[model samples]
Target: MPSANQAQAKVQKLRDQMAQMQASTVEQIAQLKAEAQRKYEELQLQFKTEVAAREVEVTRKYDELQLQLQNIMKMFQQSQNRSS
Candidate 1:
């Protein structure tokens, strides 16, 4: 019942709508990728910060243990000298 020109115009309109939908989908994908990259970088920075803090704590504990060992050795030496 429709004229040939009218049918062609309807097809063109549907094609234009499809193109617009594709463009919108592509834009959304790009935005999601950018957000994911930003979050990954933030997590990496947090992990490095935590690792550095742990390293400092471990170094402090080692130093304290070394000092305690040195004090014990000195006491032993003093006792030996008194016996001699």
Candidate 2:
């Protein structure tokens, strides 16, 4: 049988090992979280850029349609004046 002092020493060593393992696990989790956050920010910026490009495209199309409509209206007015 082990002496009481030896038993206490063994228990203390196990406790120290457990603490170190816990600390290492915590550090790994923190690193992973930081990496995930960085990825999320990058994705968000990319999405924003895509959305802005789409918005600009839609606006350009709308402006082109508006100009076409105005031209048609002017032509109709001129035709009506000629008939009168």
Candidate 3:
């Protein structure tokens, strides 16, 4: 049978191993959280950039349509004046 001292030593070793494993698990969890946060920020920035680009394209198209409408109105007025 093992002596009391040997049993106590084995118990202490097991405790130390458990503590080390817990620390390692905590560190890994922290690393994963940091990675997730970085990815989220990156996606947010990309989304904003895409939205801004789309807004610019839409505004450009709107301005072009306005200019065409103006031209059409002027041409129609001239045609009416010539017919009068």
Q: Pick the TM-score winner.
A: 3
Could you tell me every candidate's TM-score relative to the true structure?
Answer: 0.87, 0.87, 0.88
Clashing pairs in 3: none
Model 2: worst 10 consecutive residues (lDDT sum) = 1-10
Ten consecutive residues with minimal summed lDDT in candidate 3? Answer: 1-10
Expressed as tens digits, the lDDT of each residue in 1-83 for candidate 1 is 99999999999999999999999999999999999999999999999999999999999999999999999999999999999
RMSD of each: 1.4, 1.3, 1.3
Which residue ranges in model 3 land beyond 4 Å of their true spot?
Answer: none
Count of clashing residue pairs in every prediction:
0, 0, 0
Q: Which residue pairs in candidate 2 collide?
A: none
Candidate 3 accuracy as lDDT: 1.00
What is candidate 3's TM-score against the reference?
0.88
Query: What CA RMSD would candidate 3 show?
Result: 1.3
Off by over 4 Å in 1: none
Residue pairs with clashing backbones, model 1: none
lDDT of 3 by residue, 1-84 (tens): 999999999999999999999999999999999999999999999999999999999999999999999999999999999999
